[model samples]
Target: MYKARAWLSRSFTALSSNPLRVCVVGSGPAGFYTAEKTLKAHQEAQVDIIDRLPTPFGLVRSGVAPDHPETKIVINQFSRVVQHERCSFFGNVTLGSSVSLSELRQLYHVVVLAYGAESDRALGIPGEDLIGVHSAREFVWWYNGHPDGKNLSPDLKSTDTAVILGQGNVALDVARILLRPTEELATTDIASYAWTALEGSSIRKVYLVGRRGPVQAACTAKELREILGIKNLYVHIREDDLIKSPTDEEEMKNSRIQRRVYELLSKAAASASSQPMLGQRELHFVFFRKPDSFLESNERSGHVSGVHFEKTALKGGGPGKQYAVGTGEFEDLDCGMVLKSIGYKSVPVNGLPFDNHKGIVPNIRGRVLKNISGDSSQVENGLYVCGWLKRGPTGIIATNLYCAEETVASISEDLEQGVLASSSGLPKPGREGLLQLLDNRNVRPVPFSAWEKIDSEEKRLGSLRNKPKEKLTTYEDLLKVAT
Candidate 1:
C-alpha cells in the first residue's frame, strides 16, 4: 500500500500543471469531498482545502453526535482524499479574514466555496434573549471541543427536565447525549470536559419537541428510531402526540431495523405510562408544539428556562400531514433548560455576496451572484458553490456527493470556456490582477502539502489514545504543530 501510494504520488506530481489550481474552503465532509473530486477528475489540478478549526473533518470532529463512532469512520476515507498528491490543507483559516474569495480567485483558476454552514437558525421567541436559551449548534461544538465553542458550558449539573426544540436529527442527537450513560461515551471522541459535565447530569427527562406532527417531522426514520432503542430509558408517546397518517408500504412492511425500533418504542412507551416508575430517566417524542416564546431567568444569561408553545392541529390529514401554526390555543411547559435545534444556518463570508436571511451565498444553481438583478440574480461564472453553502443547510452525507459533482461539472464547463479569473496563473512581470485582489483584501489561503503533515500528526496522536485523532482545537496549536 505504501509503495502504491508513493507511485501514485509521483505520477500525480508528473501530471499536475498550472491553470488547474483549485482551492476549497472548509475541511468538512463537503469541502474534502469536493477537493477529492476536483483532484481525481483532473489529476493535473492542485487542490487545497482550508478551515478555521485547526483541525479537518469539519462536523465529524466538531458536530457529529459523539455516540455515533461508526458514522465518524467516514473520516478515514476523507484522510485518503486529503492525501492526494495534488491536495493540501490549511487549518486556522478564516475565508473572509485570512483568505478572501476574491484573493482565492486570483491564485487559483477555480475557487470553490464548499464551506458548510457556520451558524444556527435563531428561535426568535420572547425569553430566547435570556440566560438559559441555547442552540444545539453551540452545545454540539462545546461537547466536541470546537475552538469557537471552547467556553460554552451549560449548567446541566442540576437539570431534571430538558427541552430541545426542533425534531431533526440534531434534536434527537442532543436528547440522546443528555440521556446516555458515561460508559457508552468512553470510546468516542467526546471532549474530556464534556464527558465530565455530561457524566454529572441530573437530567431525568428530555422532551424532544417538534412544531409539526410526527409524520411531518424533518428527522430521518433511522435517527428517530435509534434514539427510541435506548434500553433503560422510557419513551413516552401520547396517542394524541402522533398525528394519524396513512401508512406507507415501507412503514407497514416493517424492514428489519424498523421492526426492532417499533418494538423498542412500544416497550419504552408502555413502561413510561404503566410503571411511571422510571427511576433515573425518561425520554418523550412530542409533536404539535410550535414554540412561540422562550422562558428565561436572566437577561444576559442567554440561556433558556422553558418554552411557550402555540397549539397546532392537523388539517385532518394526520400529524405528519401539513399543519398550520395558529392561535387556537397555547400552553407553557416547565423546564430549567432549553436548546433550539430548530435547524443549521450558513454564515456569509467576506466579499462574496450573501443572503443574511438564507445563510447561503446568493446564487442561482451553483454560480455565485454578481448582483441581485431582480427576484434573484443568475449564479456568477467561474465562482461555484456546493454542499451546505450552495444550498441552505440541509441533507445527509450522501446528499453532498451529487451536490459536489454538480459543482464540479460547472467548474469543468467554466474552464473549457476560458471564462475563469483571467491570467491567474504564475506571477507575471508588471500587473497581477488576482494577487492585487488578494493584497486589497488581505486574504491568505493555505496550500495542500501543508495539510498532509497536519493529518499525519493528528492520526499519530489518535492511534496512541484509540480515539479518532485528538484534534488541535486551538488555531495556535494547529499552526504550531502543522508543517
Candidate 2:
C-alpha cells in the first residue's frame, strides 16, 4: 500500500511539472476549434497549429464563396486564439513534405490531425478528362485564389450554358458565380483573374442537377432561397419534380427545413411558368437526373460539349433513407462546361490508417483506431483526429464546435488517467525543437506575424481596386509578400 501511494505521488508530481504539448495539423475550422478547446481545458497546455499554405484559416479563406463574407467572421475568433501567448501558428509547413508524422509524434504529447478534405470525389464517368469539365472544388479554389487552382483559366467565353451535377450548396455557389454579374462579385474578395475571366464570359444559363427529388436535395433551405432571390435571373423547374412521394412527405413532416425548401421550389416553379424568359441570365433546378457520361464538343475537339444523364427515381427505404435508382430513361443537355460537385474527400497522411471506402480516418470519439472496426481498446496512444477527417466531409462550420469538444474531452480524460504520461517522466521538445528541425531541413515556416505582412499587402492591393481584398493567387506571390 505504501509503495503504491509513493508511485501515485511521483506520477502526480511529474505531470504537474511537465506541461502538455499539442500539435494540430491543418488550420481550418476543425483545427481551430480543437485548439481553442484544448487551451481552455488544460490551462498549461500549449498548441502549435501548422498549415501547408502561407495564409491561415483553411477553407474559410479558400473554400467559401466570396460574396458571403459574413460566414468568414469566424476568422476573427481564430485570430484571437492564435494570438494567445500559449498558442502559435506556423504556415507553409506541410506535414508529408516539410515534416513527417513520426517527427510530430516525437515533439508533442498529442497530435490532432484536422487537415480538411483536399480533393473532390470524381464522377468516374467517361469524358471526365475533357478540358471544359471541372470539379466544383477546383472552381471554388480558382475564384478564391488558391495556388493550386488559380491557373485553371476555364474557357468561360466559348459557351452560353453550364451544367453542374449536384444539388448541394457548393453547386449553387458555382451556379451563382457563373450567373451573377461580375460587377457585384468585384466588391468581394474574388481573385482578380477570375473576375476578369467572368467579365468576358458568354455563359447566360446554368443547370443544377440532382439524382434525387427535391426532398432529398443536399442543399439547405437558406442556400436554395438565396439562389432563388437573385434579381433579373429566371428560374426553371418542372412542376412535376416538386411533387413529393409518400416517403418524402414523411421526411418533410419531420424536417422543417425540407418543408421550407419544397415550398420555395414550388413557388419558383409557379412563378417561372407565368413569367416570360426575358432575363439576361437563367438558373435551372433539374431533379431526377443521374450523370451517365460527358459528351465531346463537336467544335472544340478535346472539350466537353454536354452531359448525358439517366433519369432516376427514389427506391426502397423510408424518409431520409431512400436511394436513387435508374429508370432506363436517358436525356442529354448541351452545355459548354460541367462542374461536378458531388462531395469533397480527404487523402491519407503517411503512417495513418485510412478507410478508403468512407474516405475518413477511422476513429471513435476522435481517437484514431488502429483498425477499421473502431474498437475502443485499439486506439493509438497520443494520436487523435477531428473535423471532416474524423467524420466524413459533412456538417457546417458550427458543427465542428461540438466535434472538437468531444476530441478535447477525450484528451482531457486521457490526461487525468495518466494514459499520456511519458515513461521517462520528461517533457517533449514541442515548438522549440520543431524550430531546430525545420532550420536543419532548410524549410522556413511562415509565422503568424509574417502572415500579417501578407494580409496587409492583400488589403493594400484591395484598396487600390476599391474592394474587400485581392488575394495573391500564387505561392510565389504569397511567399514573396510574407517574406
Candidate 2 worst ten-residue window by lDDT: 4-13
lDDT of 1 at 382: 63
Error of 2 at 350 (Å): 1.3
> What lDDT score goes with residue 415 in model 1?
55
Q: Evaluate residue 468 in candidate 2 and report its C-alpha lDDT on the 0 to 100 scale.
A: 84
Per residue, candidate 2 scores C-alpha lDDT tens digits across 1-483 of 343223223322235567788999999999999998888777778899999999999999998999999999999999999999989999999999999999999999899999989998987889999989999999999999999998788999999999999998999899889988788998899999999999999999899999999888888889888888887888999888988788999999999988888888888888775553665588888999999999998888999999999999899778888899999999999998999999999999889999988999999878899988878899888999999999999999998888888888777667767788542466898999898999999999999999999999999999999988989988998899888
lDDT of 1 by residue, 352-408 (tens): 788777777776556778754423445565677888988878888877776776677
| Over 4 Å off, model 1 | 1-17, 243-273, 298-304, 315-321, 372-379, 421-472
What would the TM-scores of all predictions be? 0.83, 0.96
Give the whole-model CA lDDT for all candidates, comma-separated. Answer: 0.70, 0.89
